[model samples]
Target: MSDDGRQPDDPLSRFLHGETGALVFVREVLTSVLAVALVGLLLFAVSGVWPPMVAVESGSMEPHMERGDLVFITEPDRFTPEFAHGDTGIVTYETGAAEAYTTFGEPGSVIVYHPPGSGGSPIIHRARFHVQEGENWVDRANPDYLPATSCEGVPACPAPYDGFITKGDANAEYDQVSGIAPVVKSEWVHGVARVRVPYLGYVRLVFSEAVLVQIDGGADGVVPAVGGERVSVTGSERTTTTGVVGSASPTLATGSAHGTPTATA
Candidate 1:
């Protein structure tokens, strides 16, 4: 009998008291690992996607979804109202075309996507509207909205494809000028965020810089900014802006000189 009035062969009691050897400790660790892996595999099977969870690294989706918020994403087709062009979903604007506006119903659903050809990290933002190939997007919500001067000769509003034009709710520009290439239907759109587990994602974001750079870009990498994502103004060159609001002055609503100059919108 043991001091606690338990039998020596009480395996369950030994585990309860954590009175075990290295072998037992190793067994416990392995059990935990396996248990977690099993749960993950189950979620993957149920969701029909490999990566069903994503960490928010930028403030782009701010006020609505903050930095470090752990977001649960599901395959787009798994849910209703698959992303489509025009008259549905959130309304997006051209890179330099939109200055101010409000989206419906809790700033719209946040989407995590791989912008085609950018080779950056997954982006978390909202789909304002989708542009059909060879279509032009204008801002009725923006009073002083002006298309980027560089977009003058461009054949399309976002890009030369049919896909959703996404943006941060608090941002003045679209993803294109903000540094993300363009989201395409057949190529780049990944998944949409359905659920959010707040603040826990910071554990990863705190350690994920190289990962962050890959997610956004080395320059456009999302660093937590004023309860929002990184801010930039694109003109002849792109101006990368960091820091929280009120700490740093807002970038010009029009343009600046920081990243490579490209045709706008």
Candidate 2:
């Protein structure tokens, strides 16, 4: 006990009983902030990725990964699977199916990647396969996922430079075919989703909605395109900006819709 009859060496006890109301409130706020910071640091240390978690915002990846799920992600290079796509450390659904590898209830890794030419948010989807530059990948793609019979009819066929073909689990068309995104380059990937915690992501989503309401006055308008062009997206129309890879406007109309920056699921 100190001269004031409080436990002199116990900070928690001091916080609980010895502090004034205003001081205690301040301490509570600071302590909560510090606790959150520590948890974030720990997650970063374990995952080797900054802002290691993402919130799911759409049903594009439904049944396997649903909206409002908090997904923990890691650097692609960490925990490399035996059959990862080269040194990029990503296993496509094709490779994973063959090797019996699986993640997030599917036969491949779920990744958070920046859509090649879009600008809204990073997409969370499965890597279906890898295509080499000029490789006419149309034949290799799943027939069910193909909208066209020939490579010429597909936007990203003959492989527009080597990259992965991505798709949402529940969406009817491939992201490339539907203009959600072009082929995803490994460099555009932010992280590989490793674990999912249900319902926690809604907290982030609620805050995001509040911010958007403030910024855009609650109007859900088309997201601006790269290079300052305004894009109007209709169902399945491919959008291509000058000197930019082709896709839907960065709103990502197909896959995992609207990942927030640092990104969503």
Query: Could you give candidate 2's per-residue lDDT for residues 1-265 as a string of tens digits?
Result: 6889757667667776656777688788877867766765676677675556665655567677765566666789898787899988899999999999998788988777765556544667888999999989888888888878899988888887999998877766677787667788899876777776676555554544412322122222322111011111111122121110011111211112233121322
- Per-residue accuracy of model 1 over 34-151 as CA lDDT, tens digit each: 7756765665565454444555555556566555555554556665342323323333433212434333234344555544344324455666556666665554223222335444
Model 1 clash tally? 13
Query: Clashing residue pairs in candidate 2, if any?
Result: none
State each model's CA lDDT, in order: 0.42, 0.60
RMSD for each of the candidates: 11.3, 9.4
Model 2: residue 126 alpha-carbon error in angstroms = 0.3
What's the TM-score of every candidate structure? Answer: 0.62, 0.76
Assess the local accuracy of residue 154 in candidate 2 as a C-alpha lDDT between 0 and 100.
85
Task: Rate residue 262 of model 1 by lDDT.
Answer: 8
